[model samples]
Target chain A: MIISVASGKGGTGKTTVATNLAFSIGADVRIMDCDVEEPNAHLFLKPEIEEKSIVFTPVPEIDEEKCTFCKKCAEICRFRAIAVMDQIVLTFPELCHSCGGCVAVCPEDAISEIGRELGIMEKGRVNGIDFAHGKLRIGEAMSPPLIRKVRSSVESDKGQLGEKNVGKINIIDAPPGTSCPVIAAMKGTDFVLMVTEPTPFGLHDLKLAVEAVKLLGIPAGLVINRADIGDDTVKEYARKEKLPVLMEIPFDRKIAEVYSKGELIVEKMPEWKDKFRDLYRQINEIGSVKSASHKEK
Target chain B: MKIAVTSKGPDLESQLDPRFGRAAYIIIVDPETLEFEAIDNSENVNAFKGAGIQAATAVSDKGASVLLTGFCGPNAFKVLDAGKIKVVNDAKGTIKDAVRSFNDGKLSFSDGANVEGHWT
Candidate 1:
């Protein structure tokens, strides 16, 4: 089963839940950190990266010598990356989505795609879990492409590592927000475990996330971190929404200190390992029921 | 010469809009005859990205030789420059007043983009 851990707001313990859950689940599990912009799972997991590869996105390059300034390429580009004026045709590589629409629309065959480095993807193993993540280059606005690249590594690994050994449980640590990057990471997952705090801001963003997952037709459950510090607004919202509260980690000073020091809570407190395992079990139960109903539909 | 003035309304009497990309309307006026046409700019205002570039294209396609607006960004400036459209920055008052200022040489043309992209 493929499960994704996500949060709508930042610093809501997504990395904490994802890493601990991977450690608890043990054998035949893969963890992919799809938060390309700020992948923090590596800080806690500390997987010794065995392989690294650069990621690239194709951006348009104009062939000025063979061009007619027909303005067709400019008119067809939705991103406005290309502009044609009289004798000049300018292409802004930064604004290009690499959709290749301009190239296809160009009557003179003047546009060609050149690869631009967007980020890097690294693969490693931590404990027994196979790990992979993408790190987007600074100032890069597009991250969905990098996130997709990281997720695709899971498929490639399944083929190389043998289907039986790799497909048991794949957990994706998704980025914050309900935007393109988050959706890209959440796609094709059996379940989404949304990590959230108990405050009003947490509850507000949680609603937005829940809506996003619901739109994608994925089964999701909530994990409320620092559950005791804030009001019960999150729990109330979850109750009204009929969403299950899978686990609640009360605000503990020791846990906070350990987390601040880049240590996994599950490793420090072995008893919490059982709690994470139970969280996985609850997720499995929910997944089975949701899939069964989906099959019926 | 055809001049495009960013305006808050569809008429020449409307106040000049400070924003180039997110302006409500583009009033194209023939300065010599005072004849004009107003084009809605609502499309660029709601655009998620590349609004300035798209708005520049719109103004260029209207066959306007000059653009009068409060501010212009780098991307928009590049397109407008390539289109050979002179941009008069920090343009205030109504479309008619802006046109008068342009004719009287009271307004100065921008050397380049006056603001960063997404300045609102």
Candidate 2:
């Protein structure tokens, strides 16, 4: 089962929930840190990376020798990346969408594609759980390519998604937002564990996240971190939205202290291991419910 | 001379003015007499992928041997090179200033004129 842990607001303990829960399971698991912009899961898990691969995207290259200056390639381009004149062609690489429409329209086949490296995908093993993460190059505008690369790595380890029972649970540490990056991280998950605080900002962004999850039609549960710091607004929103609040991690100075020192919570509070295990079971039940509903539809 | 200018808005008259995604307009001014006709590429129907190819085609179509413009990325530079159009970067002040700069042979292209992402 794949569970995506996401938060609408930053600093809502998504990484904590993801890493500790995977560790507590103590089974063959997989964890993916999809926050390519600023990945932080490695700090806590300390997994020894065993493999790495570069990610790239294809951009169009126009050949003026055969282009005939017809401007056919430019005319078909939707991103305004290609243009042609009497006999000359101008191209703007930055504005290019990497779509092959320009190449397809070039009557003379003047356009070819070249790959541009955008980021790296790293694979590691923490305990028995296989971990993968994405590291995007600085100044790279897009993150979805790298996130997709990381997800592809997970698939290479198993047979077709449902054909083989890898018998491992997957915990996806998603980026904080309801934007394209977050969606790329959370898609294809069996269930979503939304981590949020009990504050007004948390409630507001949580609503947006809820809207997104509903649009995707994925089952979701809430994990309210720092439960004592803010008011009851998040709980009220959760109740109204009909989303269940699964785990309530109280605001404790020691947990913050251990977290700041790069320590995992399960390692410190041995008794909470069962609580996390129960949380995973509850999450699995939610996934089964979603699967049944999807079959019905 | 007839020249094509790359603009976001649709019209030849908007070449002297700038707007978002407008980048630079192609104005085919006569090198000897400084008189010209301009093709305003505001419809940008052909500018599907990036501004680079659009600018190259506009310049080439206008029978322009020289391209006077602001900053450009590498992909567009390759198209310009393929078309054999001379490119001058960092042309500021006004369209007249840019034309004069081009005529005076004062425009130059640095190695990094075409960087990644948008001008912003």
Which candidate wins on DockQ?
2
**Candidate 2: DockQ?**
0.44
Deviation in Å, model 2, residue A1 alpha carbon: 1.8
Q: Please write out the lDDT profile of model 1 over residues A86-194, one tens digit for every residue.
A: 6777888788788989889888888889998899999999888999999999988889889989988764442254656444798999999999899999987889999
* Tens-digit per-residue lDDT, B10-113, candidate 2: 33334333321245345667756767665555654334345555556556656776665665666666666776666665556556655666567786754444
TM-score of each: 0.93, 0.78
Query: Alpha carbon lDDT of residue B4, candidate 2?
Result: 30
Off by over 4 Å in 1: A156-166
Q: What docking grade applies to model 2?
A: acceptable
Docking class of 1: acceptable
Query: Candidate 1: DockQ?
Result: 0.43
After superposing the true interface residues, what Cα RMSD does each candidate give? 3.2, 4.2
> What TM-score would chain B receive for each of the candidates shown?
0.95, 0.69
Supply the TM-score of chain A against the true chain A for every candidate structure: 0.95, 0.93
Error of 2 at A195 (Å): 1.8
